[model samples]
Target: MVDGRRITRRRFLQDSARAASALALTAWGLEGARGTASAQELSFPVERGASLRVLRWSQFVTTDRPIFEQNAARFTQRTGVPVRVEYETWTDVQPKAAAAANVGSGPDIVIGFFDEPHLWADKLVPVTDLAQYLGRKYGGWFDVCPQYGYSPQRNAWIAIPIGAPGVAINYRVSWVREAGFDPDPARFPRTTDEFLRLCRALRARGHPTGFALGKAVGDGNTWVHWCLWAFGGRVLAPDNRTLTINSPETANALEYARALYETMIPGVAGWLDPHNNRAFLAGEISLTNNGISIYFAAKNDFPEIAQDMNHAVFPVGPVGRPTELHLFSQAYIFSYTRYPNAAKEFLRWIMEDTQYARWINGMLGYVSHPLRAYTNLTVWRSDPKALPFRDAVARMLPHSYAGRPGPEAARAMAEFVVVDMFADACTGRRSVRDAIRAAEDRLRRIYRS
Candidate 1:
């Protein structure tokens, strides 16, 4: 929690107003004049010789190289400064960053999933003064972008959210229709019981449900968290300092997950994240929990499947609330870099409405933006095929929750809790109750240590 003294409601409202003003100015074509003045106020004046070194995810850097390069070129055109990028995978990024922070030799900026903030907090330079910087530059920060990467305790901006991927139930429209069920939202599952009955009905017709049960990190972690949320359980307490998975809600969630497993495709227990995508592509599974990445993959690589693919919000639980929506808003910035201001400026540039749209459209379905301004852009809103995803984003954005934003919490989740108990529960090797208890125990030990 943030210290009450540092974040009074008066200050929050004031900052929000400034952010709104900045956004309005940007929309009104004051980019160069406004940004320059703002930049001057925030930093020691853009040194004509100043440059930036940034670290980013390899896949995005590679595929979107041209777009980013063009954006970089434009930035140079506008500000007479240059930006350099170094890219790596999440697996390789941490060790390299840790080594750099150890030796004081890291890049100025870093891009990573939500887990990155918690993993690299010590090295990070809090932009809690983000309002100050924004107030100086363009008059304010963009309202929506800040929600993606703020740490209340540190009272700082850790990273800037570039894009978001939201979780939903992906299903084969034709298969569901053939099963004599309407896949429309109005007819969607309203409770766990209804979801199970539907899954059974699909299986009885020979279309198996599938989930990521493989040993891979992505699939395994997603399945565990989604189930935890859907069952009214949580990975940790609201303060994000304790693992409370042993509650009745958590046990029930696990039981619900186990029930889904029973109707999953044959050998699904052996499937990993990639395999889940393959299973869906091969037409062996009718439904699964997935994100825009899979939907985009289908749309681009397998058009036929994409044509048949449709997504719906996760089912509600017996408790009357809907499934927990897990949203991954990819953020950028690394603390070890010598060029924090430059990196921040670059982030600010990309998050602008114009640049944001280009990045979103170029992702070809790999990314989703959560901001209402971006989603309502003419490109996404005007397209019929994009409507389902657009609507899903709108509906799920409000309820979305992220994992703990601290290194200890992240390590516990990645190394102990997610990898262990979730695997055990899905394979029927442990009951939901036992899994939650064990996870909570492990997490307690992690927190204490």
Candidate 2:
């Protein structure tokens, strides 16, 4: 276990206030250099007769795709390079990107989830120049972005962190109040024990929470990682080489999972990414964790639910601070692409403040920006509901926190090692000791020295 004194309530609250507050765009005092300097400092020449194919994950909200395509069309019109954008279901992106990397031919660029570029760093083009330029132009990236974008093996940036459709606590306001807990972001439960009490109280009122336990690439792994790390459990030590998942801290987390699972709605054991969304929208679940997609859907269709829903960051655990894991997306160009220049330029064009701001505001903060300067965007401040999600990327612990991002971390996460370990304990499929031992064995093989 880690030193308990490492974090304190006073420190946590201080950090929470910083994260919850939306700082000004000029927070870095670079308001004058925002757009004009970027065009002058860096420019990629378009390759002749170049046509680009980009692969990205399918959209959760309908508006996201149209805005993306509109920006792509603008890129083509300005550069005379035709671009085609295709999407894969969230679960298929990693495997498909791996396959393309192995074959040396496919889409010129891929926008995939966290640490994926690390899994095939050698096969991807280094965007160090572009990444650094963006950082200087924007306020700079959040701390977690570099964990996904920079590859230690290559000593360069293998990907461009776009943004994260951050997962937050999605709860029904009335349900929380009925259970005698205030749903306000400031007044919500601050610790895991307090959170458990709220969950049990909700269950007693005939409303229960549900979190995915199945092989959900996004939701399942995200929450399970939070549960494990909440009590100071970590998959690997700081060296990124030592196996450290089986311990007293891990056992405590598993015991807590078992208790939390009891208060959840039935069949969470089989729940995938979409299950909780459906349940909550159907009024069968009183609380869950999700992106702004839930609120978006409710606003468009279920007005009453939209009015009643609220969001907050996950509760602090025994660790005395936030140890959250959210869905992060990054983009990478393939080494084998014929039009590397065209691909690079296209990426650069869309990430410019003009195009990026339009896309972000259109999506209404479904995807939290990785650049710190974006915290000042009107989208975050336009609606009170989106404010809780604005700094999620800034506050989250990336995959392999306390370690480094690499093929081992990516492979372990993709294989669902942590998710399954928590699932096994929560479902009573294995005793807590067995679950920890089994997870340790799997992690040992993955992180073999």
Candidate 3:
């Protein structure tokens, strides 16, 4: 155990992969759709003898896999196509995807996280027609959807965004109340300064907060990026050309980060994505930022904690409005797949309102929709605590914040440039100024290429 807490996988992943688990599309079926009317008639003939292998991140919520498998079974029973779905730890998905792209063989379809499609756009089959049809039929994509799925270089959609696993503040109501702060959403901290005060107050009561500072792929990146942008700090200018991370705003963010870090439970500097989740469930941390997984786990395993837990959106910072970052998952077909038509059809079938709604509802509020119409889904309002996550996509800023989307932003994030900057200062390895300067230098090398 690290820091007297057990390190373990989310229990859902253990049994989900073994659960029991579709459709063929003719090449012309997707291509023929010019509008919503034609889209309804889309019966992409499944390529004869087509079978698919799909790789996705492990389920963060318990019901996610069974419902997903049930949907796949429905697709197969209806369309006479077979599908095999596999799961990997989320952090491992990127390298496995890279291997698939490099060797031209692996899972036929990969459902992975943020900007992965951008990293290998040239090697994937374009789904622009399918994307367009879905857009017309399902209202329209969110503002950040195209930024991740549509490739500027290819002038097409290399991937389809499935949903975002919304991240927000998870805290114990009793601890928050005892710490002398109201636990109500409306009464929660509304500014970064107030947030720091809350953290400090919680610590004074022996219930310190925690946020990842290590090289965690999801949690680490989400919270750090939010902190950076919340104070108006950015890696590049609006043109996406000039390096601008060394400014006063960034220094302010780092100084603030250092203060927050002081109020955190010990050992956060080495905490990974799952660390805070474990600590929170173990009742070692009074507060932390995470997706809905923590609440579900507590609901099932520790009823007392679950009863006292509540969620809220991050407070507004110096930049003024909400500036949160969430992990977005998207699916793409490798060009080498022998069943491209079947792959396209499977994606389309699952994203259809019927199957998509079932899959999303099963996740409860764990996953937020990328399509605008899904904002009205019943799951968002299923529980009062789920309400904060309902607008994650709508409230989020894309990677690189004020700058454009491209490989530079993806590369910087993959390398943990932002997370490490905060780690450096908070851990006392570097002063706040040095940490900002180091981040600026690293970003310059990345954006210059």
Candidate 4:
């Protein structure tokens, strides 16, 4: 984690008070057909000589970085705003953003993942004007899009969600058939019981699967949350105030995670996010949970592996429904930005169909659009392997699992409470009861004050 991102309660309340003014201007109405903010209303004219810097996580699909840099250069070409793009690991992105948000002195815009905005919405500029403008120009956002960035206290978006990377099972078709399971993507294992059996068969065939069990902010959290929700467990009460992580359903899920980890290749209890990506690419395993980045990596570097590998929906739980955790790609324009209008202008340019479509094509299937209209981007339909993930952003629930998001939900995600619970049980670090109790205790502290 980036150093010094933690928020003390006194500091947090202070920032929330400071953050209210930005929201107060547009707080009157946020839901249903609202009037758009014109370039004139958002105020500052695009400062011609202004320079804007955006800090973002390193690209998931790898190839998108250079393509994005090229796009940034093009943005500068059209507008006079000079742009500099910086990259960080997914693990480092939020903390760095937190550091910047608290200090009010970094990145004109920063890439935010999980619930970063929820944690520091008070410190970030409201983007409702920009969001609504984009919605009017390019069609509206998906139903879930606003929740990731919306500030109920302010009644505005803390950040405009750009997109999300959907988490799903990435399996080798050839290996599945070799292990005596149907290789057909359409007929792949749909239930948790069938998924477990297939993993056993694949393991016996010497292609054991694994997922990151360490504090992988994205991969570990997404898969663990999926398992927990699949088994009828959730992290928060409907109130978003009470901690509901310790339950019989949660224990059942933990038990399932323990069994699932046993089917994985050894040493997964120590793996990080990139470790499994490297493992799968090295042909060390047959199946794992991941986004389309793995697919692009295989296609670009290991064509034969690409041919063998394909995507599948996250397996259904015993509850007869599947739960997917979408790792969102959201960017915030900081309140401290000197070039607010220029920064907003740059984002608007980036969202335009021509610019955004080109960028989406370059990413392959790594990111799905936050808005429903952009679902027609054709990147998914062009590649059959990517089609399964087209609806990732549309189907996601908040990390808190219930009710509106807040600092409490964001803190729970950043702390990786659910992930640690499963890892504790799976790795023998703690019994299920002890693990759940430990998680509950930690959450109590997070939700306090």
Which candidate should be chosen as best, given lDDT against the real structure? Answer: 2
> Which 10-residue span in candidate 2 carries the lowest summed lDDT?
24-33
In lDDT terms, how accurate is model 3?
A: 0.85
For all candidates in order, the CA lDDT equals 0.62, 0.88, 0.85, 0.81
Residue 409 error, candidate 2, Å: 0.1
Query: Mind giving the per-residue lDDT tens digits that candidate 3 earns over 305-355?
Result: 999999999998998988888998899999999999899999999998899
Over 1-449, each residue of candidate 2 has an lDDT whose tens digit, in order, gives 13656667888899777654433223322223234234246779998899999999999887999999999999999989999999999989988999999999899999998898988899988888788788878867787877788886887888888999989899999999999999897898989999999999999999999999988877888788888899999988888887889889999999999999988999998887888899999999999989999999999999999999999888988999899888999999999999989988988888888999998899889998998788888999899988988998899898797788889999888989998899999999999999999999998888883
User: How are the candidates ranked when ordered by lDDT, highest leading?
Assistant: 2, 3, 4, 1
1-449 in candidate 4: lDDT tens per residue? 22758888888899898677435434422332222332233334787579999999887776688878887899888776789999898889888888887787889998778667777777777888878766655555665666676788766777878888888789989989998999777999999989989998999889999998888877898899899999988878888777788899999999988888877988888888888899999988889988888888888889999998988888889777668888887888888887888887777777777877888878886888876567888797798899888889877777777655778778778888888888999998999999999999998898885
Error of 1 at 111 (Å): 1.0
Stretches of model 3 off by over 4 angstroms after superposition: 1-41
TM-scores of the candidates in the order shown: 0.78, 0.91, 0.90, 0.89
Show where candidate 2 strays beyond 4 Å: 1-40
lDDT of 1 by residue, 1-449 (tens): 26656787888999899898766445422233234342553433455477887676655312366776678778778777788877775456656766666777767766665455656566676654443444334333333344445555555656555554556678888888887778875577767788888898889899999876655444555556656676667666666565566678777777777788788887866665567777887888899876556666776688998888777766766656644434445454566555666666676677665676676666543455644345455546554445545533344322223334556555664563754676678786787667667877777787777
Best by TM-score: 2
Which ranges in model 4 have alpha carbons more than 4 Å from their true place? 1-44
All models, RMSD in angstroms? 7.3, 7.2, 13.5, 10.1
lDDT of 2: 0.88
> Which of the predicted structures, 1 or 4, would earn the higher lDDT when compared with the native?
4
